[model samples]
Target: MWHSPSRRRREAGAANMTRAGRTQDQRWVATAEGEHLRGRRKRDTKPEVTLRKAVHRLGLRFRLQRKVAPRCTADFVLPRHRVAVFVDGCFWHGCPDHSPEEFRGPNAALWEEKIETNRERDRRNTTQAAEAGWIVVRIWECEIRRNVEEAAQRVAETTGSNEAPRRRRPAMPK
Candidate 1:
């Protein structure tokens, strides 16, 4: 196929037009919403770390960001007690208490759908983990920030049971 000079130039320019006018390579688009989304941390988040530290100080050590079942990697995984902890952000998770103005910005529908999907996924994951004999501990971000000690206490109470800590696998010979 013979390519005209104008056709080549047109094609070169098309490469720069990204989806939703987003920058190439997913770089920051220099918008408030864009910056907000980019700032979302997966692990080692402040709330997650605070809760982890609080729980640790209470002598309830657990694995961080480990999968106890398929498609469900908890923020804190207590294999001994078969517990999976998830620290959820209010805004991202669509907390009703959050200010409505937060979701009133550009692409509001997209944000609502995203948050709804997150809620549904959380429900499904909780059920799946329960069926697999694991307890799910969900702490709201505000709750963790407001009272980390209370969250730690909840974890302790949930895992502190008459049943001994059950090992997931047999101990290897040392």
Candidate 2:
């Protein structure tokens, strides 16, 4: 039978799809929304930027994406005081405020399992870091975005020497 090039291409593409659908361990289904969600970054998110800027303004400097343990890396690490900060995203980290089913879409069960796994991993990492004498500060995304200064202050207090954080002043131009 005669066929157009576009039609033939579509036919060939459709043949590659699995009739059985996704496997058990599949991360996301083949969809545009799934691809977009999968592309999210683990570090340097908007909340992280806001918190970092606030902390810097408070005269505090820390390492970004620093490795606290062999398996886990923290969002911010203060080597001097052994403090590790993690800014958890509501959707990805399974925050109680948001419903995972909404974000999960078609993969509701899979997404719930994934979120639970994430929370468990976070808990394990926190415990391990604490046991290693490292202070783990887990700040929620909403809290950081709502008041960056307050978040910075919390970090400073946790990592500081019990004194007020000194704000840095820019040098006057000659």
Candidate 3:
């Protein structure tokens, strides 16, 4: 019984798989939880898009996912104002309003650790950006969902571009 090179390599790697079927390098996650986590987008999420639209509506232009400091990439950056804005997911960033205080599952400990690490990294990144002379704004997902205009306003204000929001003109009857 001869196996192809690819098959042999796969077989060799199988030895590194944990009982949960994830490779040693991969963190263990419950099946349902894993699916949800995998489906999450790292960028251009709905809240981010809505915030972007609102910011643009406020007459502020920004660059998306720009790196303003070493190892720090902001979701969007107002280059002229030297502002770096980050839109963080509630659960991923351990939001006080949404993130669970205690995770429950086989890998519950890992989940808690991961969330904490995310928060630490977020703080570190914000500090790094600030140290590099960039104004940093961190917005929670719930805040954006609740009132995107407010979130956008916060960003605009941080950039010192708090111009009056553009108003729509009423339609004229023919």
Q: Which candidate has the highest TM-score of all? A: 3
89: Cα error in model 1, Å: 0.7
Question: TM-score of predicted model 2?
Answer: 0.77
Clashing pairs in 3: none
Looking at model 1, residue 54 earns an lDDT score of 88
- Model 3, residue 42: C-alpha shift (Å): 0.4
Give Cα distance to truth, residue 114, candidate 3, Å: 0.4
Q: What are the RMSD figures for all models against the true structure?
A: 6.9, 7.4, 5.4
Candidate 3 residue lDDT tens string, 1-174? 998655665777786665556676576565776867867889999889999999998888889999988888999998989999999999889999999989886788888888889989998998899999999999999999999999988998897755665566988989
Clashes of 2: 0
Q: Is candidate 2 or candidate 3 better by TM-score?
A: 3
Tens-digit lDDT track of model 2 for 1-174:
998655665677744434344233354455678778878987899999899999888777799998888698999988888999999998888778764545535767777777889999999999988988899999989888778899888998997576555655898999
Better model by TM-score, 1 or 3? 3
Mark the regions of model 1 whose C-alpha exceeds 4 Å error after superposition.
1-32, 99-102, 162-174
Candidates by TM-score, descending order? 3, 2, 1
Candidate 1: 10-residue stretch with minimal lDDT = 21-30
Q: Report lDDT (Cα) of residue 155, candidate 3.
A: 90
- Taken over the whole model, the C-alpha lDDT of each candidate is 0.78, 0.81, 0.86
Better of 1 and 3 by lDDT: 3
**Reference-based TM-score of each model:** 0.73, 0.77, 0.80
